[model samples]
Target: MKISEIKEILKGRMLCGEDRMDAVIVAGGAADLMEDVLAAAAKGCVLLTGVTTDHVIRTSKIVGVETIVIVRGKNPPKEFIEMAKSFEIPLMVTEYSLFVACGRLYMNGIRGLDGSW
Candidate 1:
């Protein structure tokens, strides 16, 4: 599903990158470890995490994740938002827990792309 669809279904707040919500998200990875994200996330994927650090943006850029969803109501730091803009990555803040959010997307038919990494 498109990022826009996920936003509407989850009632998520668009923290940034609203212009690219129509971007396709064939896969998603939820993690707090920037290293893991950088190592495992697919190109053009959406990242889901509760982390509010600037490293998240850096990691997203290195891994080519175009979208970020900050789960569990955690707001990203201002610096991170600016970094996201500089990197042209869209950011969203959601009240849903990581597990619930992933489940909702999965139930709605958002599947990972095979061998996309």
Candidate 2:
């Protein structure tokens, strides 16, 4: 699936990287712990998280997450969004909780990076 498809699936709001919405999305991972995400996320993957902080963007940069979906209607700080923009990372806002978001993606054929990374 593509990131744009995810936006449509979740009715999410794109906060940045509008041009990147069509980027290919091969897989996804859900986690609030940046440490875990950094250790396991695949390259070019989408990160689903409830944590909204500057550290999230920093971790994403280090871990190679192309897009971030902030769950539960949470909004990252303005500075963090600006930072993500500067770094060319796409940010999305979804009202669905993390579990529901993950489930929806999975049900729609979005797999995790397990073993395929």
Candidate 3:
């Protein structure tokens, strides 16, 4: 799926990296724990999380996540947004919970790193 499509599905607002809206997202994962995300997320996956911290941006960089959707209507901090922008990562926010966001992506044919439904 495209990053633009994921934004529409999740009803998210782009926080940065609008130029990357056309980027293809091959897989997705949702997690608040950076460790779990690193362990389970695939490279180039769109990460769905409620944690809006600098660590999230750092983790995304480390784990090769170029797109991130902050769930539960939480807005990311300015520092976090700046970090993501510096890394050229697309950051967005949605009102949906983590589960709902993940379900929407899954139903739209975005699979997990493990290729599970």
Candidate 4:
């Protein structure tokens, strides 16, 4: 799914990299643990995470994640935003919990990293 579509589906607000709204998410997963994120998601993924840290951004960059959705309406610190900007990762804040965000994306036809939900 497109980042724009995911944003709409989750009723999210863009926090950074608005220019990347047209980018596509090839896979998706929800995880707060960076280890789980690394294992579960791959390149061009939409990551629904409750944790907002530079580690997440760095890991996402390493794995080529396409977007980061901070779940439960949480906001990241200014440093996080700056880091994401530097990495060119799109950041979005959503009111949905990690599970709901994942479900909504799945329902909308975004598959998991393994190609199944």
Error of model 3, residue 3, in angstroms: 0.2
Writing each residue's lDDT as its tens digit, candidate 3 over 86-116 gives 9999999999988989999999999988867
Write down the lDDT that model 1 would get. 0.83
Q: Estimate each model's TM-score.
A: 0.90, 0.95, 0.95, 0.96
Q: Please write out the lDDT profile of model 1 over residues 39-91, one tens digit for every residue.
A: 77888787888898888888888888879999998877789888899999998
In candidate 4, clashing pairs total: 0
Model 3's C-alpha root-mean-square deviation from the true structure amounts to: 1.1
Better of 1 and 2 by lDDT: 2
* Per-residue lDDT of candidate 4, residues 1-117 (tens digit): 799999999999999989989998888988888998778778888888999889999999988999999999997999999999999999999999888888899899998877664
Which runs in model 3 stand beyond 4 Å of their true positions? none
Under the 3 Å rule for N, CA and C atoms, how many clashes does model 2 have? 0
Residues 23-74, candidate 2, lDDT per residue (tens digit)? 9987899888998997889878899999888888999998889899999998
Q: Which stretch of 10 consecutive residues in model 4 shows the poorest summed lDDT?
A: 108-117
lDDT of each: 0.83, 0.90, 0.90, 0.90
RMSD of each: 2.0, 1.3, 1.1, 1.1
